[model samples]
Target chain A: MADKPLILAVDHNRRNLELMSQFLGQEGYEIIAAASLEEFDQVLGKQADIKLALVDIAGFDRSVWERCERLRAENIPFIIISPRQSAAIQQAGLAHGARGVLVKPLAVKELLGLIRSLLGE
Target chain B: MSEKRLPTGIPGLDEVLQGGFIPGRAYLARGGPGTGKTTLGLHFLTAGAANGEKALFITLGEPEAMIRQNAERMGFDLSNVAFLDLSPTPEFFAQVETYDIFSPAEVEREPTTRKIVEQVEKLQPSRVFIDAMTQFRYLAADPFQYRKQVLSFLRFLVERGTTVLFTSEGSAEAPDADLQFLSDGVIDLEYAPEGRILAVTKFRGSDFLSGRHSMRLGERGMEVFPRLVPEVYRREFALEVISSGVPELDELLHGGLERGTITIITGPSGVGKTTLGLQFMKEAAGRGERSVVYTFEEGVETLVGRCEAINIPVHAMMERGTLEVVKVEPLRYTPDEFARLVRREVEEEGSHIVMIDSIAGYRLSLRGEDLVSHLHALCKYLSNMGVTTLLINEVEYITGEFRATEVGISYLADNIIFLRFLEMRGELHKAIGVLKKRLSDFEKTLREFQITRYGVKVGAPLTGLRGILSGTPELIE
Candidate 1:
């Protein structure tokens, strides 16, 4: 797992996003942190080898979801991180072909496993 | 009674339930920690889901992911089932909600109950399992409130045509009878000397086997064996003759041992008790009837080799599936498990002859001291199945005085064959005689027996002998 691929994580909370980034970084993934779609776009420009994205998808606007569609078209996979996980969220997540949706306050071990599996590590 | 029943999926449990659980009723499976209560609940949901019915597992203690992982390991696919995670998730703890009006239990249970009601209304699942039902009990401040809430929930589920199975960890704090009274049936699992035992304490409208069934909980989940009550399995078997491989020995018993009877062969060690049983099993194989020899003392290889040395085709018979030698691990097999194994061999494999090599060795495998009683029941069961069984009992004394067997199991047997070592002119000799054969005239004369590479040799009667019953007979002048 040397020369790990970069993963971009987008969250509304700075501390939560940084904590997840640090935890995954220790697990050998190079994490790029982003707070919004603007920052995610900036990170995408800088990092050519972004393996996957973990983004929050629990707002009224369709901007985050449309970005997810664009990512899917670019052959990049993403998993949604929502504050609330329900059957509707899961269905929406499946329709978008997002890897899966993780509820907020994530179990660190489960998050790590999901990241590792998606990264093919 | 005829009613709409659902199978429990666990082997032998349906038989104990006398058909299966009455559907659309709530059942409680109560057990201590690690006693397989959760697994049993999952089995019910899985069985329902497999039958194209929607199922729901509402976990109150463990997370849905952990439950799904454990269920998958046991070969249960829960894809069709929905999960209502009532346990406090990370967000539940993080969210700050003011709860000044409700008590501690109500603070937790209100939202959980609302979620369950919503899920049931939406999914309309036919089966629902509520794990750690005791958690709700703990939430309620008093016993009466807890009982009322549970009864209401059970009634709600049953009214919607949902068959429910709830699990409770039997603890000292919470009373199990509270749940037992509310549920339509109660399956109580407990740790016993032999293994875990599952018993149905109550079934509201149906009659179930009112005894503890031996249960095993492993990766494949629970397996229960209803207690082997011999009287229930009895049937009428014909009085046909089944011979031993040795021709002369068969002559001593008129024709041979009658079918559906237990034949006890008592002898000292190294006096050919096991070999004689093998001879009968070999003959059973030759007659195209299958046989199973459960040797509690020796290994299968040694038994096969010894039988092969006597020109007996133990290996060949096994190769053709006519004979099977099963070595019962010492102190491992319970009488319940052993009886089930024999029943499977006879009922499933169609084996006609059953043999337990030595009673003493078999006793070492039993948990309780009532080895004779167990043997009596098992022999009766085998006889009723029309399976002829042979038991070898090794005695303590070799000569001077003869007792048929040390275990006092002789009376339970329909026929008794006594083998002894006799010293004649400073040379040791083997003798075989039939002491008792119920309703059959068997010759009482002692015959000289020998174990050679060519198999058991039964010679003519030792005619010039007196006081033979004393084990030390003198030749007449």
Candidate 2:
């Protein structure tokens, strides 16, 4: 039997990370939750088998885009979660090699579909 | 004890509710902002706490500390009352984490429900007060769910032997009609042009006073003044006629005013209307009966001075504890409030004669209410209590077409004694006549009336003058 796919979820809000881990973990994925830049870097440095990532950029400053760039260099497909819909953040996500830019209050079905298609399931 | 009623801890409101609320039922106090809904809730819980019953105050709007401070200012002792403070804390805003995957109704309702149930089960309070029950509307998924949850919540309290009083902050966007239907009774408080009014719109198992009653929120807290219902109060008294101290004036009345009848002293300004009412009070004082004069138009000192000058001996009557002169500030009281004062005088102090000095001043106090109806209710209440009532009406026209009474309130009077400025022998003089006496016959002829320094004087019937009713008499034969 093959092990489940591993998904990295990053958000400043503890509750939002808890919600994501509970929801996506039920979908046959093992989730690694991080609440700060240090935790995100530590997980990405050692874990090269990461399948996908969901990054909520609410409390993080401008340095969060560099994390998105690092995910791109590591050949990991990821989605950026913006608190509001703005052309600047969408363009930044595109520049940083994000597969999609989802707004805060991500639609549950839409998020699941995006992850499944990225993982080829 | 299980079938006893609950006092609402408000003065005069229990009487309006006809001996307080029935136990083990939910009631709604519906009103807008600043209408004393929260104060009323505090009154309920405090009253229960005073009786050594467990009382719970579930505040959903104001925090418990602020509520306690306010209640302390109003002299409410809340030591025994338990408070379930469900109001939002400052940390709710200071926290950086926010979640929207699930709606607030889904995320918060279960925990809040658990908290309330735990508190109630732990305290076992017999009295419960929920401030702003409409706050639950946000916790329910929809209006249907809200209604179902509130109904069950209230039933849960009632099944546990708790009498509940909840308040709803009704607005145009969200009215509390559903809550009104859910509760066993509804008390509505509102602000009208006259003053703050409280009305019991619905009571399921009890009979309540059903009208707009006057309510005041003052420094001491809320006080309700029930509308006077004449038919509810009655006493069996003799129908004997009383005598005026002046013999000729009593002859004009055929004897004097009846014991329980209302007499209207209608006249022009300065035509001795108040003086005649005072004369009757003097006679009642001589008989050792107490009299009260609600002088809306005159100062107490001025009335005492004028009565003493005309030999009515108001000072002596007051000294003897048989007379009371109340100077009423018209704008300071609503008509219902004034009626309460008069009720205390007649029913509590045993006053036999009650006089409202002038109708116009009383009308001014009404401040756009239905003057005739309020006056009728007051007079009927006084009459039913077997007390003599004198209503002084000042007509605007001094010497016109001879109207019996102005302001269209003559029908409320059982006896009409009108005074006029008559032109007799090219001299302006006062004449008195009885237009109608409901209980007995009165003299048909007018009499020469005068107010001398000594006392009120009346001459024999002037049959020699015809057309005296016209305000200008002509001698015949």
Candidate 3:
């Protein structure tokens, strides 16, 4: 698990954060969890080899998009986790260079497959 | 099999189907832009929604927002519809599709199928409409893969009892050839210089009206007028003589117009052909039989006004709901569409009298159809339905060497009522003559005709004159 690719998870809800961390951790990926944009920035500041990011863009603010932009600048692929199955939400995520937009509570199999492809597994 | 059918919520279309589309099967609507394909699909889904059935509209062409706006404008409420909008908006038009074309499997096929399947599974809709199914043609450049995806999608939907309708913008050469075999039926709409036409090219298990029928778009949306097949509508009618409301005109018509017969009033313009037809229409209304007037050259208000001035009581008859006036825009209607209007009034609304104000206006609109033959067939159908028909034809020259009509519809007309404008003694005069009446004898003498404030007044025969039938009269010494 420790040798697995480091994946960052950003979400405002603590339960969703814990669930994602546990699920991805059990799937043999090293996980870093953040509850806010400030915490996400702090995590990115300390990490040098973050492989992929999963950001919950539900009720997302300007800072959330800025974080996506930052990840885009770093050549790090990311996925948008939204509570809506709306085209507008998916389009907004795609506009920001997100690899994919999946609705929650996540399609676990599809999400894992997406993570594997994004990480070049 | 008529197991179950998905009703396409367009007026007169189901009648063409003899029922409706088969349930759990896929049908394709093929047409070009401005052919009302998208509008028809919306009607299908909205109708399903109205029936308490879940419905979905997956648009791959126009933005769903624009579609919604258009549907609303057409008086369709789509609040109950679930949409899978994969189309890009104007703001996102410039985004490059980095859909990994190098490996077609992962990029296009999975997303397109998965998106649709996921949405359908979520909504569990009974009816689905896929707009611009041809977009998939571009997505999968490899024809084999495109066919495979579409076939599988159809199979999957049918298995789940999800009846489907998809629209395509097939080119003129072979618009629906690519995926036609995969569909259970194909309803083809064509917009040509001649007119808009629709046909059911193929249907797997059900019978449908096959030949190209005329289609038109109006305030009520798309309506298909199945070709007036006369044989199917032939029936016997009571040979009762109906009054023309004008006592003198009725006397000339041998106690009035006969049921299930065609009477054409031929003359140049402004010779009271329309008013003559209106008199017969007013007579039908008085007897409590419904009548419909297809006013191609005149407005309803103007026709009604003309009738009221002559004490025809057109307004009272209209307000009584015994008569209907359909003012037609010549360029906007086809002969078949006009036929459908007449059929609807007769069959559905129980109209007993059918009148076309002037054939010249009808000819201009539906000129693609051979004019005389089309009118012949339409009149035959009306007569078969036990309805009295009056067609007014305008001659080209008001006072030329006498001709029966410009188009020579004499043989087709069961009765020829000839009205003419003459230069009698340097004074403009009009004459009405019965050229032929198939069912009975008519007055052979020409009558001096006048349009009065109280209506048409006809005088005794002008026995002292000759050559009046040739536009110039001479006294016989």
Top TM-score: which candidate number?
2
**Per-residue lDDT of candidate 3, residues B78-118 (tens digit):** 99999999886665445433211123333345567889889
TM-score of chain B of 1: 0.96
Give the clash total for candidate 2. Answer: 0
Q: Which regions of candidate 1 fall more than 4 Å away from where they truly are?
A: A1-121, B91-102, B234-236
Instruction: State iRMS for model 1.
Output: 12.2
Q: Ten consecutive residues with minimal summed lDDT in candidate 1 chain B?
A: B97-106
| Docking level for model 2 | acceptable
Q: Identify the superior model by DockQ, candidate 1 or candidate 2.
A: 2
Summarize candidate 1's per-residue lDDT along A2-92 as a digit string, tens digits: 6778888777666556566666777777888887778877876676678898887644256777778777877788998866758887787
Candidates 1 and 3 compared by TM-score, better number: 1
- TM-score for each of the candidates: 0.78, 0.86, 0.70
